[model samples]
Target: MKKYILDLPEFILVALSAYWFLENYIGTNHFNPYAFIVFAMLLLQIYFKNKYVGFLLAWFISLFSLYMVLAVISEFRDFPTLISEGALKLLAFGLGFCFLAMGSAVLMFYKYFPKVFPARF
Candidate 1:
């Protein structure tokens, strides 16, 4: 298995980016979790077991995370009382935990299962 920690920064950034973009553009209070899951699957299928693919996912995740943080910050500043603290906390927890788990799994596979993440042309 590859070390998913390797993709931490990217995951945070991408996930946050997606979160913020969605919030700002859609004016929504929650992230559509299904959308990110679909993205994850697409990345896996399209990349076809390349290390660079991992990097790409990481970058995307980072963008997403950046968005999320921005949204929370903006909301907190404008209407702290209007914001549901639980929602923010839950989103952070879910995003951080799940993304790390998925990223780590990918890294672990590459680390141990070289056949899966084979050196390529």
Candidate 2:
């Protein structure tokens, strides 16, 4: 029998982080309906413990998150409007959102496609 909570794959970890980041980044409740699908697949990956399946989910999430970030930027010229209050905080939050999306994409590519990153530390 295996442990209840074993170490997840690097891609899974990254995907999960990106998922959580997106959860917090979104302003409205239930704004993204597809996020629920990603969350469910993540749960499936955890249950099955299949690296390949996890990789597929992670890749899909990374691409989707990148697409979302790009789409938002193209649609909105400003960060949730140029609010005079807490502008710095909003900027920081926006930067974090972009960074997480980009990080997910870069890590997914580097770790899986090119195998630039080692499988395990």
Candidate 3:
């Protein structure tokens, strides 16, 4: 059960990646580049069963989360616009923070358990 809990982040990432791919396919009728990377990471994780794979996935998510934080902060300069948007902006901000927190937790796990997340190269 503890091991399953530790693997939860990877599972969440895989589910989110699949949803994003489907959303882009159905809604935009185009391929999303990030979806390819997500799929690759998922496959690699399954093949290797290594914590390093999870770290890589978390790193990718963290980068995106950081970008989202920057984008939201820039939008904040137009505070009135955000207010006019109502709950949508708030919801996005909340999700961004959640992603940031999850990313940080994954990184800390790798940092503290270096032997568990050995470098493949």
Q: Best candidate, lDDT-wise? A: 3
Candidate 1 per-residue lDDT, tens place, 22-88, comes to 7654785656665666456444633464555555554454455466656655645564454578666
**Candidate 3: residue 65 lDDT (0-100):** 66
lDDT value, residue 61 of candidate 3: 72
lDDT tens digits, residues 72-101, model 2? 555455646655455555555655665665
Report the number of the highest-TM-score candidate.
3
Kindly indicate the candidate among 1 and 3 with the higher TM-score: 3
Which pairs clash in model 2?
none
Q: Candidates' lDDT values, in order?
A: 0.53, 0.55, 0.65
Q: How does each model score on TM-score?
A: 0.38, 0.49, 0.66
Tens-digit per-residue lDDT, 1-121, candidate 3: 8777666656666676777788898899998988867777776775677666555556667677677666666666556665566546665765666574466546535643565645789
Q: 1 or 3, which is superior by lDDT?
A: 3
All candidates: CA RMSD (Å): 8.5, 6.8, 4.5
Tell me the lDDT of candidate 2: 0.55
lDDT: worst 10-residue window of model 1: 1-10
